[model samples]
Target: MPGIPVTAPDAGKSALRRRLLAARAALTGDEVAAAGEALATRATALPDLAGARTVAAYVSIGREPSTRTLLERLRATGTRVLLPVLRPDNDLDWAAYEGPDALVRAGRGLLEPSGPRLGRAAVTGADAVLLPGLAVDRRGLRLGRGGGSYDRVLARLEAAEARPALVVLLYDDEVVDEVPAEPHDRPVRAAVTPSGVRRFGGVEEVEG
Candidate 1:
């Protein structure tokens, strides 16, 4: 019998993700914080967010910089924010978020909103969906934390007729030329980094 053959793309992506994670872990808290601030500044300047009312974003974990500042800025600008709640079925459940106090520690050390759990209708009303990923490519492909949670939720959102512009936040170095993409991996519309916001598969240029 022949052994299972690993595809070249899969192997390359695995190696790249490992290297990226290792490099990210080497950064100090202050560095991550500063990078996050810069990324947020660039993100807010994107035209897609100009009239966005409801936004869906994630709570960062570990060495990943926190989105607290961005969330506050959005709220102050009258944007209704939603955060994900990890369900027992390993799927994402969403809830309305007001501030940091609305979040509590959940399973796997992830912070989730403690407010009213919203349904698919609320998600479909969002103007933008900010994704969390280990890495992203110039093509908009996202490499998540080995979990299909975001993919599944994004699929659901699409099915609900929610065409919110998808965006991913990443470090400047995490933006690569390519990433191994699976069928279930939904590509984001744009990416925000310390360098600036880049539109994937779009004609928008990163302004200086």
Candidate 2:
């Protein structure tokens, strides 16, 4: 093992993800809650989501920048909110979010919508897709949790020629200088933080 070089892109990504997750785990409940509120306010006002009729988002677990508030706010605005239901193959199957009561417990400590499965392709109809990430670089490269669920979702959208506004939710500190990126890794259009919204690409120009 001494002579082995561990410079592969995936290795670097795993290390970065661990560090970021550790940092997030250190945040207090109050800190995370406050950030979630701010994110709801800032994101709801963003042009990318302001006119969106359908949004694909997820519920936050642990110390991740909470998406619960933003999801509720989006729903209150008459936006059709969809939540992911993780499939056995590690792919995401989406369903309509019908308020907090409709969320049922799922594996991996996740809360998923208990509505009828809309099939994996349902996400293609969303006007915007909110992704969960441990961190994002200034160039918009996202560091996911290595599950590759969102990767499949992105690919599905691409295959359908669907152009949706891609966004990530994170704490302000999670927006860093750089993150290792690979050729197939697509950059998100923007990231919403508690402080404000960070734009990296043409989020406003993405068509529904």
Candidate 3:
């Protein structure tokens, strides 16, 4: 983690990230499990999700709102789910999500697919992407951990001119009024919470 320079502006994002992670860690195991089930139901109900031919998602680590149920449900329907494998450079390489048994523990507390690497650009072919975040606001701005991993993914998506339906899965409280944002931060298509789905950028009309 050394040698990475931190800017003064990043203080806002760094602080918010810590607070959100703290709140998330307070939730009990039962609470997390229940939220995962609810998230699966609400997320899969979205047309973008229900209709996706391929989805790029991640394995939930720690107390982050669980995505296992949703991932499993997606696979059960024959959707080709992709999970990220963290590269040494902190950029992501993806692989197909076969099942829970197919996941191998990578360092830094991540569970990645043991399947063949599909290369970085494989995400451009996805119909939808399920992103992990500490919070997403009404403006659809997502607050990610300070790692800058997903930021690179979004940049890759943009450079490819891929317009995949960008979505974030979070707890209801994580959907907020606002979070720190920068000029390069692009709004997500929608945010799926345990209670309901919040659409942004007229994404609902597309799903309609």
Each model's number of backbone clashes? 0, 0, 0
Q: What C-alpha lDDT values do all the predictions have? A: 0.78, 0.85, 0.86
Model 1 alpha-carbon miss at residue 115, Å: 0.7
Flag the better candidate by lDDT, 1 or 2: 2
Pairs of residues clashing in candidate 2: none
TM-score of 1: 0.89
Q: For each candidate, give its TM-score against the true structure.
A: 0.89, 0.91, 0.91
CA RMSD per model (angstroms)? 5.8, 6.1, 6.0
Instruction: Arrange candidates by TM-score, descending.
Output: 3, 2, 1
* lDDT comparing candidate 2 with the true structure: 0.85
lDDT of 2 at 159: 95
Cα lDDT of model 2 by residue, 21-86, tens digit: 887888899999999998899889888799999999999998888888888999999999999999
Q: What's the true lDDT of residue 14 in model 2?
A: 74
Better of 1 and 3 by TM-score: 3
- Which candidate leads the pack in lDDT? 3
Arranged by lDDT, best first:
3, 2, 1
